[model samples]
Target: MNRKQPIFYLCSDALGDTAEMVVKATMQQFAVDEVNIKRYHYIQTEEEIYALILDAQENGGIVAYTLVEPNLREVMKRSAIEHDVQAIDIIGPLMQAYIDTFNDSPKEMPGLQYELDAKYYNRIEAIDFAVKYDDGKNIGGLLAADIVLVGVSRTSKTPLSIYLAHKGIKVANLPLIPGIAPPSEIFTLQNTLIVGLTMDPNHLLKVRTERLKVIGLPNTTSYTEYEPVKSELNYGNMIMKQLMCPVINVSNKSIEEAAVEILGLMNKK
Candidate 1:
């Protein structure tokens, strides 16, 4: 028998996006109801809450909503019971207690203002390009980069790029396609430090095959055969050798370790 999966519909304009992303991240950690969780946002009024309740009822799962207003909270609680769904109002109790217990301490207001400014003062932008094509992207402006990474395709380039980027590195990755030759501009960028990433031939072939299938491409020998991978790696290594670039084998390295290694490389340079 299938277990009763608990689904929540969170509702808060201020906390909506961050809360939804948090729940989504948490869902991945759970084996139960991992795929069943969803979030609803921008719920400020009673009608909006009621609409979400109706939606959750048809699905027959828990309906967790949040509200800032006291009157709306009461309305939602009644609606939740009427819909026969488990409901959780995330804000009511916390707000009541906070109001009752806290004094008007305007002295801490400056610190709070400072904290808010510090938290979001330097949010990073999305990496518009995928990591598989990083070898082709230019990092000439990456002197602001906390760490830079270079590697051939499917060698965990995208994840590492995102990871280092999250750590405040304006990480620019260039994907190296063996025998295709890196563009001439890459050779001229002496200001930016580079690290070469390589992986085992067989493992790369397997990963490439899976990626090709997902993109509806043919898993042909030309794209992921052992010889082609080995040749590519050889060419990449030769290019790095000629350039006197430091190389790292990433087949066994975790994302954190790769980022750390890159940081060390940058520090040494």
Candidate 2:
């Protein structure tokens, strides 16, 4: 473990995704690669809170927690104070602010944000739309798309499309195969935001080779070769140029990171 890396301890009485989201988004403010995230979910007992605080003391790390029950929340606060560790109550302060502002009380419910609301159902519909149109399969209904992503193989088109879909964006991803022209309607659609995703040829080759290996196929195909990957990238770039869409590189970036840029580009257009 790198000592320069900060150990972030996340605790919650429910699944710790919200706490983790807080930590990860805060960590992005800094330009660092080494962050050790330790998640302690379903933490209901005072004993569990104490034990985690002890671990945080031992590591000299910070704690980020979301505890709804007052007793359990106090236990975490006291334990962190006793252990002399920096503890961040991810939900408490905001919950208090909200309660005071609205003159209401905390419901003390754990994981209430995970309820299947209208937004969740919208994401489900978008996911289904992306799956139905993946790999340029259903080009006829692409006129209904909110965003169209075009890229050669392994440029993260599918994952990016799905991630955007989860945010209620109707996304369609088309694979850029050499010698095949893109859908004619894509050029005609004026309202849809068309994006061209690209990746480093070497990285694409490695990704394709690993994918082939996972599917029990040999890596000897042109799909996994450096020269062929480079040619594909060039051809894909030519097509993107013909479409006059914004090009984004996905190499060495996470889905969220690329989505941020994609959304930014979409907003500009």
Inter-residue clash pairs, candidate 2: none
Candidate 2 has an lDDT of 0.89
RMSD of each: 6.5, 4.4
Clashes of 2: 0
Q: Highest lDDT among the candidates is held by which one?
A: 2
For 174-197, candidate 1 gives per-residue lDDT tens digits of: 677765666665676666676778
TM-score of 1: 0.59
TM-score for each candidate, following the candidate numbering:
0.59, 0.75
lDDT of 2 at 20: 91
Say which candidate scores most in TM-score: 2
